[model samples]
Structures are given as C-alpha cells and as structure tokens.
Target: MSKNYVLSLYNKMGKLPFGKKLFSLFASNKAPYFKTVSPLITKVVPSECHCLIKKRRKVENHIGTVHVIAIANGLEMAMGFMAEASIPTHLRWIPKGMDLQYTAKAGSDIRCVALLENNQWQVGDLPVEVTAYDENDVVVVKGIIHLWVSEKPKK
Candidate 1:
C-alpha cells in the first residue's frame, strides 16, 4: 500500500470508536498482541501509547498476585503498539525476543506505556527496546522488538 493511503487510513481509523479493532480485522489470528491490548488500552498519544489491565481475582495465582505471564502479555502488547506505529505500512514486524523481570507483587492495575522519538525514521530494518513497569513504577518486563522490512521476501 502507498504511504499516503496508509497514513490516510490511520487518520480515519483514529477517529472511530473501534480504532484499535482495525488492527484485529487486518491481522486476525496473528494479532494476539492487538487482542490482548484492545480492551484495556485507555489512550494512544503521539509517540506514545498507554494500556491498562485490571488485576482480576480470576487472574491471580495461588499467592493472590497477578500471574507473571499476564504481566508479560501486557508488556508485549504495549511494545508492539510502539513498534507498529514506528514502521511504515509497507513493512512488517514481529517480537524476536523479550527479557523480563518481575519485581513486586501486582495487586492492582497494571499499566504499560510505550514512547517513541518524534523524529522521522527511514524505512529499513528496525529494532525497538521497550520496558514495562508495574503500578509502583518498578520495571516488570523488557522487550527487544526485531522488525524485518522487505518489499518482497523470498517465499
């Protein structure tokens, strides 16, 4: 798709209530990050995005703390949002790997925020490192996103 077309679509989609759902429709099964975040994401700003997921009673483990995997999931989703926003429509991206550390017990809501530099990025291979924090502002997880770009890759 043309850059102009994609940017225009994003602008239009941004106005809709279900703007985030648009990602699901396009990627569907491969869009797990979108599914995980769409419901909890409260806001998306220029160069940054904020997500919120409540610590439900059901989501807690035996110790009454939120599951470690749940927190990791939120971090990945937030990072994905940042990475996606950084790339152009002609490119594609995926989570290469992540290194996370669970500090304190998560008894309340978890928020993941991703920020990007406002400067323009030239279209090419890109990898973004995103860090997620708990309600107490302690780092809970970190991810290194590796994104591959190609007009066409060998199939």
Candidate 2:
C-alpha cells in the first residue's frame, strides 16, 4: 500500500532545519482556522501527533489565561494530523464530535498531544485521545475527539 500523503510529506520535510515549523505552516494554510492558535506542530508519527500553542495575547482570554477554544483548536489540529498519519490508506476519516474537559488554568505555553493506538484504525467510531499540558507539564485540558472512519469509495 502507498504511504499516506501527509505522512510522506512529514517524513520528507520533518528532517530539514525548521521543517516541523514549515510543515505546520503548510498544514495551517490548508486548514486556515487552525492558524488562529498559531499552532506549532512539533511531531507527527504513526498513531500520535504533538502540537504547541504559545500563551500569547492572541490565544489568551480576558482572565489572563489561554482560552479554552484556542486549546480546543490545537487539540483538533493534532487529532487531524494523527488521523492522517495513522489511518489505513484504504480508509477515510472525519471528525464526528469532540468532548473536552478544562482541567486547569493554562498560564503558560500549552503542548497538545493526540494519540491513537495502531489497532484502533478500523472502520468505526474511533476515539482519539487528546491532552493539553502547560509549560509545567500540568494537564490544562483533556478530551476525546471522535472520528467516523469508513472505507474509501471505489472510484
């Protein structure tokens, strides 16, 4: 089977100097809304993706903390990258829903991780676990982003 295009791109570009940043820029351009949080995609491998959102003024709320929605955007972006990297070539996936819990105040940069087990890529309601941690490694948000996976239509 051919490698997934997103994975292939990552494999190629992720090795260059500042490649991850460039790749993240490319991804954000593809899905413009994700640019809102200025997400920096640090890593992408089979079954997992890591992203970072700095606690800048744009992502901060009136309470002097990172906004929950900004964190959600980062989580969603990580989940998308994870799905693109991990799903079988013959299958397709789309986000069906997201359930998040704001556990702690995000006072610093947030690192978001999305994870899926290798065996969890079958056609079904797949739940990708996502968590956001602050600079101190405290859980700021955690959630599941549900994906509806199905076989690709025969062309």
**TM-score, each model?**
0.63, 0.96
Measured with C-alpha atoms, the lDDT of residue 2 in candidate 1 is 49
Instruction: For candidate 2, write residues 1-155 as lDDT tens digits.
Output: 88688888987888899898899999999899999999999888889999999999999999999999999999999999988888888899999999999999999999999999664787888898999999999999998999999999999
Residues 1-95, candidate 1, lDDT per residue (tens digit)? 44444334445676888764563344334465445433355445444555666777755789987676777666666656555555555556655
For lDDT, the strongest prediction is: 2
TM-score quality measure for candidate 2: 0.96
